[model samples]
Target: MSEREVLELLRENARYGTDDIARITGLDEDDVEATIAALEEAGVVRGYQAVVDWDELEDERVRAVVELNVTLDRETGYADIASRLARFPEVTALRLVSGDYDFDMEVEGDSIREVSRFVSEKVAPVPEITQTVTHYVMTAYKENGIEFGDGDEDDRLSYSP
Candidate 1:
């Protein structure tokens, strides 16, 4: 079985069983299982995640994209700050990028005030951080493989279960 094919299939749906993958990829079920095990050992397949449409829930999630400008600590580079911020439960994702900002951060909270407090108290306090800009997400139309409300009259759920 080709590892890339297995990886791609898993990326589309993490719940795919070895038998299903074997059927689709035209590979032996045992081989598909072995490849997945090997990839997991190598840390190539990080983990599985479910993309739920939070809008339908009674408890809404507030997400924000935070842009940070930072002065590199010559000794520590970006690792120090990156790992530090990554440890926070509110930080869903963090990346060092090239653009107007040095770091792109995704954070979420139960409420806007909670997210705001996290940014002001947790993110901005780092000494190397020079500036921060936060943009709140108003709505999410599509996430992962699911699409939010398209407002169709047809009898299809807006998102896949």
Candidate 2:
């Protein structure tokens, strides 16, 4: 199969095995395996991941994204700060980016107070983190692997239940 075809298969489901891809793409299983291996070696295919709906689980949890704007100080290590934040199980994602915020973090906790404590006691204390903004998600119209599919892909869409 061509690169475009392989990409489409990956887009459909990244975790699909080479045999499955071969069946779908009408290519030899070895070719499919080679293509995937090449994609991985070239750093095009990073890895396979499973998407989980944590909210559906019988656990009391809240998810929030905390945006941090930091003054880049030469002394305090940014990685150290990130590592410190990750010590708590609540922190799920920590990313540094070029924008108004230095870091965008996704966190989950058993309760609102627990989440708040993580922000105050853990996150807020990181030096150079001059500003921290916390947004508690009331409802995510779309998130993670969840996409709202309407017939018109170009149309502005809203999710209503």
Candidate 3:
């Protein structure tokens, strides 16, 4: 099997062993192992992760997407401010976006108040940050290409004729 095929199989299921991948792809087990090692070394395969349904857990959490408009530094631009924002524990994801906002960030906290506090107290105080808009996530139907709940059921009630 080609390297691309091996990568595809690994992407579908990161836990697949070398023997399992070799059997499916019709390649030798050692070849599969070597290809995976090469991919990891090259930084193509960053790390394996389990997608957890955080909503189902006993402790409730709040997630919010924050849009930030910032004054860019003449020398470093958004990179300096973005790197500083990334260091916050509450920030799960940060991206330099193209549009009305300079940066889009995903953050999680114990409650709405906590998320608001982070934005107001922490993010707002940054010298470069001019404005921020926070949108809290209410429900997650799907995440990371995986469905969260029953696939067959519709959210709306069936109508009676």
Tell me, by lDDT, which candidate is best. 1
How badly does each model clash, as a count of residue pairs? Answer: 0, 0, 0
Top TM-score: which candidate number? 1
* Worst lDDT 10-window in candidate 1: 144-153
| lDDT agreement with native, every candidate | 0.93, 0.78, 0.90
TM-score of each: 0.89, 0.68, 0.84
lDDT of candidate 2 over 64-114, digit per residue (tens): 999987775676777877887777788888998887778899999878899
Error of 1 at 67 (Å): 0.5
Model 2: residues with Cα > 4 Å off, grouped in runs: 1-8, 38-47, 54-58, 76-80, 83-88, 148-161
Q: Model 3 TM-score?
A: 0.84
Candidate 3 error regions (>4 Å): 152-161
In model 2, the Cα lDDT at residue 84 comes to 72
What digit string (tens of lDDT, one per residue) describes model 3 on residues 46-100?
A: 8889877888899989999999999966776788998899999999999998999
What is the TM-score ranking, best to worst?
1, 3, 2
TM-score of 1: 0.89
Answer with 2 or 3, whichever has the higher lDDT.
3
